[model samples]
Target: MNLLRPFSLLLAGLSLAASVSASAAERIPVVASFSILGDIVANVGGERIAVTTLVGPDEDAHVFQPAPDDIKAVSRAKLVVVNGLGFEGWMERLAQSANYRGAIVTASAGIKARERADDDHDEHGHEGHDHHHGKDDPHAWQDPQNVIVYARNVAAALARLDPAGADAYRKNGEAYVAKVQALDSWAAQQFAQIPEAKRRVITSHDAFEYFGARYKVRFLAAQGVSTDSEPSAREMAGLIRQIKAEKIKALFFENMANPKLLQQIAREAGVTAGGKLYADALSKAGGPAPDYLSLMRYNVGQLLEKIRLN
Candidate 1:
């Protein structure tokens, strides 16, 4: 009960508090190239990481131009997440300019990319890039199986950055994988309801080839892999002719693509524009698709409803 004993105890407590504060301040800062990957990082990283999404929800990353703030964000981050496979045409330049020395994790690391099979190719076509560094299709996230790879990459990256949060990230990654599995199962059941031949639909761009390959839905578009590429008159007319010949049930626009192009196509093709699809980007919060799971569900549901044979 000496007064000196109490003073010494209080000093030790203060030192411990300071140590805890310093550790907490070291929280890893992460920058994701786009919204979909941002959500994936958030789900896996949880509270241990601070995430900044360069391209926001319902925004197109195909034609995204990084601002000064984006460079600053990348420069300050300990981890920068990109879809890689040449998805972000501007990301390499931006990262180099910012001198981002931290770990640049390619979320689509292990997935095998699908090659573009279209004969009429445009400049933005996904021809040369593969899963990690090739010009293969960059829309791998459209298939949920590939997203499992993405979640694992994110968890492993977070673990590497902050070992203390490794267990938490692993648990989150496992849970997200389960959710994706369930979603994939649900999608299969829904697709089974429709006849295979009637699964074709037209959208604004060629962003859904991976989705089509996985889900058995055939997506036709006037533009190539990159939405920034312009639709040629011959391509549009050819798509319209194909739509008329196939009697394609529905035409749709993506959240990122201009609806006017699809509207004109629909008019010429004698089809109505279906509900907007979440292709390159997700819908805003409180909208049809606010997260990865919701985005897949919404797209699948819309396809089932619109493309079903009457």
Candidate 2:
């Protein structure tokens, strides 16, 4: 009787494992261009979809190169979501290479995109910087309000692909949007505590234009809209001068960008370098900014803490 009991228990465990595997295999497959967008889609899709993120956490998407595995993932996906606004310049080529003919959803479709300004010219009036993206700055996710739009777009896309899960997607998306709205309100209140004049910040790149516009903060960066370009010597010198003259003490480094240039500028300007900010990507799992909501809160806390020193 004891031997028979052990055999039955082993058979039951194997049956449960097989059932779980089949349930997971039945989920809809979706691919997101990067981690931040992936997290948003995951929240919207919930258990109905399986998401594959190409550019991972703490990785730079500005210079991301698609691998063979990425092509395979895209080819197998039912829907592909991208940030749009020319953010993922490599997406089209990757899709072509993968022979993907599925629905490609633009997460930033309905939001008002910020245009790229030619604010990098030196005193000589020469074009001192180069931009890799289109006329719009593609970092709309920086603002939680914009992410509300993103969540809706993703939910709509998922519903079209899986009509049976429409109500579920809608409910999930609305819940996520409410959280985002709350984050935005909290952020606005936090920023209001500091005087407008003390809301200036410096970073390695111009990835926070949307955040700056949303919160009424001024963000000055060493590079242009894209992080691929290097600032000219004259341009760098001008920024250092402004940092010193303005006594901007809230200098920060981006998580995905090389910190060498910003560190050099900080040393030359005699200002201490502040903590890292999650600009283009989220932190790895178990880190400070693992998901979208956590990313916004962590960044707001860091900014407020350092800007107070200004």
Candidate 3:
């Protein structure tokens, strides 16, 4: 109750407040282009980073238009991460507009990109209509091997941003990479169980080209790389014919894609729709595909179950 005791207590409170402020300031602020990449950053950055995802879970980044709030996120970020192979078309403009002077990391860097032609299929009479991503496909994260690259790049970028946390970032990245490796092996075994003839699938769009390439499955799609574009009538007719001719077993649509086109193709082709895939985005927290590991495992399990049922 003495005046001197109260003055000392006030000084102590101010010191505690300053310490808390410093601790909060130490955390690296990161901005990720989408949910899938944000999950990767969280794993690699761990508690050392606070991530802001421009396009969040169950959201489509392919046609994502940046809002004004995104600029504020970018302006404060110490690091900006994106899937570089032409995936986030709005990212560059957003960063430029925000005057973000931070390090931009391409999570897909160093992976051997699959060419757009690799996923291109005939659209019957629609000669000009094709699923294209310039020269390279941007869905490399579909393959776990490519995600290993993403983890490494993220770790390196975080190390640069927060040198004191380099060891922790690298350790976390290695642990996550181990999980991805295990998933890749498990996927291979699952795919091997299915005969080559039974590996063909029809999806809502060309989002699974990298998945098909890695797993040795063939994916036929009605729409192009970007879900924003509607498939032409002739294009849908051609895909329907192909599915019927090939006796395709499984037809799946992405979580963010409109199911109507895939459903139409399935109905016309006389095959039941397969399970929904988490292609462009992750599922919500506590959901089946909350992270990269769960997403891959969930997708493979769905494909295996659906394809085998046919």
Candidate 4:
């Protein structure tokens, strides 16, 4: 009945316009392939981006099966980030299927990957599923220097997606790098404290090659990089023999992975069971290793703690 209320109508129009503008201004939606990518994205993107991870911390990304939801997420992402270098084998197909048009950034773009253990042919004379970090060890983040490259790539990608927030991403990435550098220093310092001979470790898997290379730790594994591959009984016997011969101080288990094999090895080797280490994924929020930084810190700390005690 109040058809003449022009002021009220004008006020409603302005309110609706403001709401629409706010909704449109919401930060760009970003999706990272895995936890490491997600962590870098969160650090660089900060609160201006909505970051989602496909394989969360502590979950194995190598054998990860991309769910339908992940495909949809990638299809809708503003900028999709992956470690690339063949890390996510399913990623290429998913991206192709989704027809995602956004920039797909390879965080390891500048990284020089490590050589595959068996650079030869598979049993079938074809390519083997075994890898050296997706051909170059997408786990390059294990090396702090490589992490610098990752942060830079992430910042650059975010800047491309949302130019207005580029400065924030760069600033945050630099600050986060400082923190990572500190962690690197602390990890090195911890290893420095242990005697060179005692620095040897036997892990459930080969996830720590970069870390070992960086920190002077000797990590021997019965199996290859991924725990998915089962080590033969002969391989286990050989490992057990080597462990006894070397007198390796402790045997370690990955938290996110099954510890049964490591436990069996420990029992057979007659050594103390070292504490859990975070390798593939980060621990859940309530657990010790929740984030990338904390995960690194906790793993090294626990390794040191157990080695020192034994």
Q: Which prediction has the highest TM-score against the true structure?
A: 2
How well does candidate 1 match the true structure in TM-score terms?
0.87
User: 143-232, model 4: which lDDT tens digit per residue?
Assistant: 888888899889998888788988999999999899889989888887887787677788887778788789877677755766677776
lDDT for predicted candidate 3 compared with the true structure: 0.85
Clashes of 4: 5
Highest lDDT: give the candidate number.
2
Q: Could you give candidate 3's per-residue lDDT for residues 1-310 as a string of tens digits?
A: 5879988999999999999888878878999999999999999998888999999889988778898999999999989999998888788799999999988999998999987643256533334344335777799999999999999999998898789999999999999999999999989998998887788777887788899989888777777677887877777788778777777778898998889888887888788898899999999998889987899899999888877755
Deviation of model 1 at 14, angstroms? 16
Please give the ranking of all candidate structures by TM-score, highest first, separated by commas. Answer: 2, 3, 1, 4
**Poorest 10 consecutive residues by lDDT, candidate 2:** 119-128
> Between 2 and 4, whose lDDT is larger?
2
| lDDT ranking of the models | 2, 3, 1, 4
Candidate 4 all-Cα RMSD: 5.4
- Candidate 2: residue 291 lDDT (0-100): 98
For all candidates in order, the CA lDDT equals 0.84, 0.92, 0.85, 0.78
Q: What is the lDDT of residue 187 in candidate 1?
A: 96
- Better lDDT candidate (3, 4): 3
Q: Tell me model 1's lDDT, rounded to 2 decimals.
A: 0.84
Off by over 4 Å in 4: 1-25, 117-135
TM agreement with the true structure for every prediction: 0.87, 0.95, 0.90, 0.86
Number of backbone collisions per candidate, in order? Answer: 7, 0, 0, 5
